[model samples]
Target: MSLALPLQRTEVLVIGAGPAGSAAARQLARAGFDVLLVDQQPQGRDKICGDGLIPDAHKALARLGLLEQVMALAQPVSHVGCIAPRGGRIDVPGELAVLPRRELDNLLCQAAQDAGARFLAPARFEKPLVNEQGRVCGAQVRIGDDVHEIACDWLLLATGAVPKALIAAEMCERHTPSGVALRGYVHAPSMVGRIKAMEVVWNKAVRPGYGWIFPAPNDCFNIGVGVTDSHKAVSGKGSKKELNLRAIFDAFCANYEPAAALMREGKLLGELKGAPLRCTLDGARWSRPGLLVTGEAAGSTYSFTGEGIGKAMETGMLAADAIIQGKAKQWNDAQLREAYEQSLRALKPKFDLYQRANRVNAAPWLADLLIWRAKRSPRLLARMSGVLRETSNPGNLVSLKGFSRLFLE
Candidate 1:
């Protein structure tokens, strides 16, 4: 079949209409740039995710004028319950929120549209359009049977982890690490009448990651297991080499006492869905002349909490700023590269610290010890929780004097 080629033009083109793409498109359009947002799936489509939004996400939503819509669609979670391998529990009190990705993404896309961004939903990005000088000019896309070539001075890639088009264009490298996420929806029968807390169950059997049960509204819950690729790589001793997140979940529900109780009262409501988790923080081929990358496509997803929505939004906002400034001043590659690098530099330290902390938690014994300590000391738990939640930096949690007082006093 001959591919029909249609032509269009815009000032800025955003690929992928997820949180990051929509956020950037909205910000850019608000700044008076003729922005076009494109996505493979139609509007109101669902993306697989943990569906839990932290406080930082709330702040981002507010900035995007999405807080009201999000609040209306989401349920507020007030606590996090941690369960250890030995059946020990640590309940940390905090404000958390949950919403399905379908609702959240739709809300964000709508906000972008409201801000004057044109959306091309159900459109697949075919490839990047390159000029004779080898610089990216824009993108070639397909909406159903019609192919369209959209030209822009700036191209922003917010295409999530599986950036197939970007990889195909040879604009970015792909690393198929063994990390996997097995997630499903479950009916929380036991917690139906009670205020539910987001839960994490840690065990050595589920090495390099923990199992989670996050509360959703309407008596439903999102439960999953995130296993590291390192664990999968090491487990290749036999036929059972691949990490079976479903098997892990079933085993936990069947064998682990607390988990068993929770499952016995709950109903498995959906099939287990799996997705690849990129573990590396290596940036994508971000810029070549007029193009840039944002969100997971640029490895902006935090290796620590696997949280990318907030970081994606933050980076998207910054990218919009850089693009606006770049366009106004006829900025060269050096200026744009400097701006992108500066943004990453400012954000990387916190992400690096979080990754280190995640490495610590991935160790079953270390996680057990930390939970034990947290259970024994509420103050320590609060400080640690603050660090994990990214509400405060780890350095500010305690000083030498405070550490001395924890034991010395």
Candidate 2:
């Protein structure tokens, strides 16, 4: 991963072809900027995720003009099933769907390409090229054996939760991940009808995280357990975490009847895979001179639900919009970077509220209370649906006052 190479040029060099990168690349390319999207992996690579596309994700896809195309290939869901520790449940209706990341990311990348962005697969980003003033001017990437230095006016880092590329670019603030998760696919037409909604289970066994069983395409269910708050301490001593994701996943299937039934009846489509999560949007510097961080690289995933897809795309487009406006207004580098930081800062309050909501995952009894109340109160269920849709502040549901009011309201 050395840096010496030829001087290929583009206005934008987008590293990591995830939702964030592709979204940014597509927008910038469509706006007439020369953009290139690069990924370490080739197309068709599977990304570990729960695969549940909620209302916010649907909205983002619609903004990108890919909603209909994506839904055509996705497994439509009626509602999200919430399961509590004691097995009590509630179904909160919302616009939801599930499609494996293998297809979702590929579709996004293809959309970016169709929108006129150059794409290079198996192209690994080595490091950023900085000018004399320390502003990132371009990047050096390794494609096969050759190293090529591609110059760009702006660089968008969308490298997901991995810290290596962030470290190379000197944009990473926290080396440790905010969380970790394990994902697996199970194929069972019999279980498909049985588990109709996107089922999310919270129990003491999976505290600080949760388990999900969502129907994916081709009679498969995407099943996984995510330790969303594992990066922090249970008490106040340290934030460093020592977790066994596999053990927790096993316990989830053992303790939850639906998960157990799915495991018993379905054929596990593949061996389980794990991925790191950066949540609460605090793990990285959002922007510096001539560079911006997007997606999980900027902590787009929610600490409460481990859902990052929509937020990633939203942040990516936000970053692109910043650059697009900066150029139109002829803003200085400092002004442009400050604007991006301000935009990211505006998202902080919501992310903090989501972190507060993570308490439900840490405390199983709290989930039970919410489920109990939600089943009894239509108002509570609507609020839960609102939270999923990103229209309601999660704090309202997790705060003590909100819980107490649930019974009376």
Candidate 3:
């Protein structure tokens, strides 16, 4: 028997209680808005991810005043060791943090609830509720066979890259192919090997996509590979047998000397899982009437590195800021759309530059040369690391002037 509850109404309805949704709801609730945050899974569910938070992510956490919380639960990563095709490598100094996604997501969601947002878990989103004029007014959700209509003055979609949510909300016709990645964890203490830096490997084996061995808390490591769908078109590598990310990951783990030696003793923690990555935000409609889309669903993931956590949270904050401020000014849908679009436009520089860098790195030779040059110059290496931290501009890293200074100067 379903329990009859009062009609669910909120000033803001946030779908998908991941980092993005939780962050947005937290901010809105802090501003005294009645926000409803919902997710498909219960609290603290494991989310497949690299779990590495680069400097940019740290900045976002700091903005939310949760840096201390993350610091307490995270493994410190102080440098990045990037390997290029043909054995070119560089070690750049920086600060990064890693923790299990299960912990991180739950912490963020709990923070939201503490700030006054209402959270509903194990509630699956069915579709966006649209009014007669096609404006999103709320969401249709199901909680254990009892359907609920969550009416809201504003709706925000933070559903990550899930295609079902996108299609249900009419955000995208079909999921546009962007990037694919496979990752798994290994809990081998013997494999720790005093390696404190995050390792990125690029070789012929995983051309166009890169492999990473990131240290996790408790002496484990997260290993993964990411490949953009446009790799073949840009690299001019003619279509051949389709590359299986899992098979490639296995071959790399079995053949790559470092990874092979480590995995020989390390046990895989779980089945290797793969997911699609969204690389661009240009095609998505950010705001329509009363609805706003953020996170990976809006293609906020970085193109080169396939890191979306930081960008996802940033977009979430942007959406919340727009709504909070718009409500103050009593702005209509047109004004709200303008504010949200402009906020996204402000982020275009980084995304555009990252795309260019992605294309530049598609060529193994150029990547090799860049890494080789950085290895020889400490100052250049620091600059390269700054890009990962978002302190330096990515456009400069891929610019001819920057290359000359790092290589010829």
Task: Give the clash count for each candidate.
Answer: 0, 0, 0
lDDT of 2 at 216: 92
Number of the top TM-score candidate: 2
Candidate 2 overall lDDT versus native? 0.89
Per-model CA lDDT versus the true structure: 0.73, 0.89, 0.80
- Mind giving the per-residue lDDT tens digits that candidate 2 earns over 1-409? 2223466788999999999999999888888898888899986678989988988889989989999999999999989999999988999999999999999999999999999998887889999999999999999998889888899999999999988999899887788788899989999888878899999899888876899999999999999999876665333222657779899999999899888998999899869999989998887888888899999899999888889999999899998888999999999999888888888889889899998988888888888888998998998898989898778888889797897898797
- Candidate 1 RMSD computed on C-alpha atoms after optimal superposition onto the true structure: 4.2
Return the candidate ranking by lDDT, descending: 2, 3, 1
Per-residue lDDT tens digits for candidate 1, residues 1-409, read: 1222377788999998888899999989988999888898888887767887876687778888788888888888877787777767777776578898888889888889899998887788888888998888888888889778999888888887775865766656554533557788778767664537777777876666677878787788887777653333333221224556777777666656655655667887768787755444453576667688887777676664566677777778878878878777888867976797688778877776656556533666655655676777877778767864676565432334444544531
| Candidate number achieving the greatest lDDT relative to the actual structure | 2
Evaluate residue 287 in candidate 1 and report its C-alpha lDDT on the 0 to 100 scale.
Answer: 66
* Runs of candidate 2 exceeding 4 Å displacement: 1-5, 233-240
* Residue 159 accuracy (lDDT) in model 3: 83
- Stretch of 10 with least lDDT, candidate 1: 231-240
TM-score of 1: 0.88
Model 3 segments more than 4 A misplaced = 1-6, 230-241, 399-402
RMSD for each of the candidates: 4.2, 2.7, 3.3
